[model samples]
Target: MMVRRSGRYTTWRGFKDFALGKPPDEEKEKPKPEDDLSNHDEIFLKSIVESPDFGRKSEPIESEEDLVVKPVSLDNVNIIRSLSEYRGNNIRTIEQAELAILLSRIHFKALIDAHDAIGALWLQRGSGIEEPPKQDKDTAEGAETSPEENGDMPVETVKVVGLRKVPGQPLGLTVTTDEHGQLIVARILAGSAAAKQALLSIGDVLLEVDGVQVDTEEQLKEAVSKPNDRVTLKVGPNLKEKSSQLTNKLSCYMRALFDYNPKEDTLLPCKEIGLEFKKGDILQVSDRKDPNWWQASHVENPDVVGLIPSPELEERRKAYVPPEADFVHKISICGARISKKKKKFVYESRSSVQLEGAELALYEEVARTPPFLRRVLALVGTRGVGRRTLKNRMLHEHPRRFGAVVPHTSRPPRPLEENGTSYWFVSREEMERDAHAGRFLEYGEHNGHLYGTHLDSIRAVIKEGKMCILDCAPASLKLLHNSSEFLPYVVLLAAPGIEQLRNLTFASNRNLTEEDMKQTLEESARIQRQNEKYIDLVITNHNNDTSYSRIMDALHALSTDHQWVPVSWIY
Candidate 1:
């Protein structure tokens, strides 16, 4: 069913007459990386680095400012090329987009040392050069400025010393960047002497080494890598709060890269093993690395770590299996919302739903009707237009009624937001990092912010048996227009008229002058008309009870005809 022949679904009888012999359509073409420009942001790139799904082709950020990096491998090129061809042919479908992300590579690297060999290791998130450290005032004042210096820090290089194995522990080292940077131990071999002694823990976040300052991991490594080092290490206890600082230190062995761990595993000496979790506890496994799940549950016994032999393992897993005919009876729903939080407008929603299982059995007849026979309901409006509020109202007013359109982005978060929640925020640095790494659906930029919508969200909504209610900027229309997998139900929400818009704007405390209100109205109208071709529905917020009634009526009509799933669970 996922495959297409002659650019049409062979199973759908009328599809052949409707789409057969059509002009070369890019959306119908094969999908690839470079061609998915709809989600052209940095965070999407980072996801590729962090995604467990990354295949052979992946990339990483080299520095803090490396946002918007793109992948450069041959695989990446091929994927991009496929997308380009698809776009050129005007083939629009979600299947093509899904193919692009699945084909991307996972990028990572491992740094190893002597005699500390273990399992093979792959790079994970936050695996890159730390920010350079600062130097002491006296040391900085005395040092001569470089020719290129314009009152800025001079270029400094980091060097690795021979790794030293702690008594009864794996090898590691004490490193230092400069006077301003704090000194700390780096990379303690898992189960190494230093680790067993418990005198030194990785990610101690060293504050100072023998009264010297150090900040970055590299700097900490440098300081402890000295001869006859009975150095004093002042460290802060790891805490979530900034004000919670603890310090301690003991004698330590310092070193550089260790013996190659062909099966790259084990932490570097002095490196914080897991800042977020306590000792002996398994840290959240990062998808970037191919960790042996069996090894993680290591009970100090090898036999138990091996694969479990069972007949069930070889057999197909069963679910609350539905019949093939059930998919035809599925319904789709979408939701959108906007709110003002912390002085900034925050938009959020449940996004999409796909109703299936026993639920579809009840509506099998209606679900089999022609896909286009019903009128689709699409809502398009500017930001802060209560689009999301209305979506919530429908669900409140009618339970189990709507689906959502998932939006994707590659923008990194500012110490807020969570993965798969607010937005899949990653570093712009990581975005560019993965761009070159080659992982994304469709990416683009709007209002200086980058946005992307991946296929996973689309598949998720469909899997839930609901129509997707998507919320995005106007620019995204072009990308959606070219993709067939996403059958758009667009509705343009515009202000009633200029005079009404001015009155509403002022009433809302926006304090807009008549001129400002008029200008805004003109712009909104232009955006609406520009996207007229995609508009399947329209609602006017003309500052009267009529607007709410009209909008509600349109939604009810659409639902009655099974044109769309409501924007909420109830409506």
Candidate 2:
């Protein structure tokens, strides 16, 4: 039978004979291009079954021998030294293993050092930057023209102002944004590296560093940390700011009443430039033209100028704080809370000047005044805090030094009582009218007799050259303490802890229960939260004598010390 093979039909009898391993026909053996039957190029046909296992059925091998004839180990692989047996005499395993890595690192560091040294040598021989094109005489003269000579319009300067960074020292300069929203060098910390830069000023406006525009501290820091640690800054003068600084000849100082970290203030125009202040931090307010943000710096370091929120801005942020509930409804006399029925507090007068200074300004303008005693010594605290006792002691022990404002009364004069001595005796109709006119500070009826402290009576004590000592309610502080008149130095007689109050032996609060002590703490906390800004000093009235002595010391210091009173008290 003929079958197709090698793209041509050929006889299949020889192929069937080759596969059967039955000896080949031997008649002829066709050779392909790859097969050579003989060196003479002639066919020498042989039996196809001559090879070993040629006819046996194909099957898997059950057993095998190793194929790798030349297997090697660490000992044999290294001819110089047997690596498997090598170990240090004293070095630990970790150190021995890392020796090569350490040497490699050393080599790398040496290479880097060599590179830097070579580069420095080459840098010394390198060409310098090309000189800038010279400006014409007219252009140079125009540059020298003053801003004022140019019709109040500031002449733009095309130059840079900066300080060099000393090696191994910080820049010691803080950044802030100006009113124009430009980044500026705000504060130069005391004893900092930059403070040595005499030419650099606090308000100098920054435009760019290392030719890269930087608007934030982060950006500036990134720009400054170039290949070379030294950086160049492009600065423009804040002409308007300079004018404002010149206009404000007097150093306007203020006492910060709140802790303000600019970083935490989300509303601050630029947090990086905002001045941080703690409670009672004396600050010199440099600029107040912006009603929201005032440029100020710590009095301790007035060289650093930074923005702080204005009083109006901070007050608006706090929103409307209604009158204190306790101060409004209840009445505390001599650091003791009395019942509403007993006190008979006038509801209409709750909104009076009692709350005038209650919500104290965040920053109070303060100035050091000549040695002078406070106009009024107003004491405040909850009931059973020994306020009345302290006031009475001050008056009793030092009669000439401390005096009380003899209140007015609508009741008829008693047999022995003299006018302006026991009480200011006034007709009932006239007293009612004066009380209605807000002349009476704490007016209310007591057993059908109208009795209350009058503004005029407090003034009378002041006119007598005596500190008018009054244990008035915390609410009355607003009406009594002010910038114009009645600059009362308020003191708070605070309640002790429950444990301290419970173990008190000197205080005569035998009637107070556990709940009463807790109530006192809560009330004291409320008053402190509401009127702490108004208070000048606080004395915990755990021991009456100790507190009394402390109060005496405070009163003595007030007169002798140069008081930092509200600047409004002066100009």
Candidate 3:
């Protein structure tokens, strides 16, 4: 028997003894180089079974390649600590958690502090920052960037009793189901040192914490709320156990886990505060290097969509993004090729207008894309590409610069939901009356419920001189394009390459298995081929950092470079 050691394989002295059970003929045959057993761990070996990167060092980029690397320093850590402290000290409500998260760079450790800070902030709610004094109406209207003084300190912890989509609330972790359909925590961020000590992993199922039995998400959250530095966890056995025939007693057992000493990576009080401040609004920002940024968010600047004002600062921020040029946009007009053939037939549009007066050019120009146009942007994806989540991320990125398209539906609104706020939950009777009166621009059945987009949704966005981004299924795209209600510019997000499509799906942590990825990729390929006939412009999303950047680039080409207006604008 041969074992891999270091970088080479060697037969051990006791191989003959270990191989005693092998047949004589099998033993006679020499093992191939590929078959040589090595000391490599199973995890490393698995990758070798495919292709290996061993001994392959990272290469230096060409000067033209323009790759910039920044050394991660201790200062980044302190900044993270300051952000965490701010969240802990100032964040006041659950409603503000998501917004704070959107506004802040706090995650991982900061998230932990935000958890505690939110509780403390809630308890001492009187410390809320006073509102900024009113300015002239014209100044307020033209305010491109919000003052940092209006910013809230990141909240420490937010325990969501239920999974309700509050208009501006952040999505906190609750003990949830795993890919195997087993009850486990999808993620946890409470500052319960005990929870961490007890080794409560992201995928660990909560049978009970501290002997406070829990079965539902709510119960798990409540169990974690106990005031202590140490806690015990009763865990349900893993999926592998269930696959075998584990007994019930074996499946459920109480295990004591303790919060070990705070790791050096423990966010400082102030670092936690930084978590809740908008990355764009951080003044005197700390410099901290933390992995939590990668932990919570699926991708860092997935599309790399925003602009950078300072060349020096932009270089620093770009370090966090994946080292890939995201979304490369080009414009074509009158059937002429432009910057890249990849963008053939694509009319790019960008909403930004550079101005010199603001303290931060990027911050001021960030909100250039108005709410209405954004609604149109939302409609660009296939179902589950996250229309709602997309809207939320956009609004979070833009703040009050944009608002959601509250559909004027016929259904009655849910409790605490307002008429012209979260949504216009209406009556079926009114819906029917609107349908008969031709008030609906687009209508459909969703989640077995009837939902319609009335003209009012578009009107609301246009009222703000913004374009509305509406989502429609592939079948409805043609109708939307032809409709008299609006003639919106269409930039089709096509998943043409199967391999690329699979990467996008898998990257999203959407429980896509290998087979599912293969199947969806094939389906996407088919759709892309079919869609090619109708698409005016196509942007194939490979789910790389380039996807969003390409989209942004395309927008620039359409809106500014080429002036290729959508039919919506002209009509």
- Give the best candidate by TM-score: 2
- RMSD list, candidates in order: 33.0, 31.5, 32.4
Ranking by lDDT: 2, 3, 1
Go through the candidates in order and give each one's C-alpha lDDT: 0.39, 0.63, 0.40
TM-scores for all candidates: the values are: 0.30, 0.58, 0.31
* Top-down TM-score ranking: 2, 3, 1
Kindly report the root-mean-square deviation of model 3 from the true structure over all alpha carbons.
Answer: 32.4
Worst window of 10 by summed lDDT in candidate 1:
357-366
Candidate 3, 1-571: lDDT as tens digits: 1112233212422332233323343366443353445623543443543343521432332442233221222123434443433454347898667655754564555654554445444335543434234333233211112234222311111111111122322223334565655466543333323222223345445554554556665666566545554344545334443332221211111111111111222322112211222322311211111222211110222211111122233334434544322222211101111112131111111111121111111211111222223235434545334334445555666654454567665566677877888667777777767766656655655554557667677777767765566554444444454444554555566543546655556556566566765554444443333333234456666553455566556545555443322333333
TM-score, predicted candidate 3 vs. hidden true structure: 0.31
The sequence of per-residue lDDT tens digits that candidate 2 reaches over residues 238-332 is: 65545434433255888877778899888875555678988778898766655677777887787666778888887776664343335432322
What range of 10 consecutive residues in model 3 has the weakest lDDT sum? 251-260
Candidate 3's C-alpha runs over 4 A off are 1-375, 384-391, 399-403, 446-448, 483-485, 496-503, 526-534, 563-571
lDDT of 2 at 177: 72
* Per-residue lDDT over 1-571 for candidate 1, one digit per residue giving the tens place of the 0 to 100 score: 0122133333433432222223243335333464467734433554554466552333432443433222122122323433433331233677765654443323211111211121111112332424233343235211222325322322221211122343332233334333444343433433333433344443444555555766676655566655532455544323322232242222111110111121222332322221221112222111111121111112222111111111121111112233232211121110011112122123211121111111111000011122242222345576434466566555466544556545556655657677777577655665554444334334556676666655566667666665556555555554444345555566677756666766665555667666766555655654454454345556777643566577667655654563322222111
Backbone clashes in model 3: 82
